[model samples]
Target: MLMAHPAVLRDLVEQYETLSALHAEDGSPESQQRLNDVAYTLCVSTGTRDVDAALIAARHHLPGARVEDDSVLDEEDTPKPPAATSAGAGI
Candidate 1:
């Protein structure tokens, strides 16, 4: 998989976090689901199996942005969760 620029990743993370927080609060289920989907997409875009590599990529592209170890991508080889029944339902 082609890696996205760090800036892109940073933006994605920001958007994901913002949307997620909103989703947790008053956002519609559809909006929350969309945010989750974006985060999942960003995680999968980095082909590296190493979570650190993916995090580094994100940091590289976004200088001054802190990419925490916790932001590492999930196990790429593992099966993804079942599809959501509706927006935000699967997440």
Candidate 2:
């Protein structure tokens, strides 16, 4: 299961809607299609079928809107500790 903070989900939905509205008003079919693609991706990624519910939950958590950097930790940053073995054990 993909777990996402409520706020993140809301931001995506808001962006999707805004893009969709812009597409409709300007008769930009290509932009509208892109927005639809984004919406679909958000839904699938969040494991949510109800886009409205996801949007509401997201808005409640993230009102001001912000972007977060998701970077992977380096191997050096995650050094493994040495393992201990029995001093007197039959091999």
Candidate 3:
């Protein structure tokens, strides 16, 4: 994984900080996307498949940010259908 390289994670962290600052200052969705991408990559580096937990952890570790992981959003109440699998998925 790219994060195995010490510098890769550090570079992403720097980018995340910069983009997050821009998002906070101007409400730029593009900057938010970039920031989220960095967060996602950092989560993936941990080698866990539990994305929700990984995201929460990432938010907790974010520089100068205190994310509320306990709050439930209305959208989360909606039921999501199971993902469709390929024909050979269980073969």
Question: Can you write out model 3's per-residue Cα lDDT over 1-91, one digit (the tens) per residue?
Answer: 3323445545655666676666643667766666667777866864445535544444444454444434223476655678887978767
For candidate 3, report its TM-score: 0.42
What lDDT tens digits, residue by residue, belong to model 1 across residues 1-91? Answer: 5667776788776776677667643677788678657656656756544434654555555677554433444577445668757777658
The lDDT ranking, best first, is: 1, 2, 3
Off by over 4 Å in 3: 1-3, 24-26, 48-91
lDDT string, candidate 2, 14-46, tens digits = 778888667653667787677767677676656
Q: Compared to the true structure, candidate 2 yields what TM-score? A: 0.45
- Tell me the whole-model lDDT of each prediction, alpha carbons only: 0.61, 0.61, 0.56
Q: Give each model a TM-score.
A: 0.47, 0.45, 0.42
Q: Where does model 1 exceed 4 Å of error?
A: 24-26, 48-57, 65-91
lDDT assessment of candidate 1: 0.61
Ranking by TM-score: 1, 2, 3
* Cα displacement (Å) at residue 4, model 3: 1.9
Cα RMSD, each candidate: 16.6, 12.5, 14.5
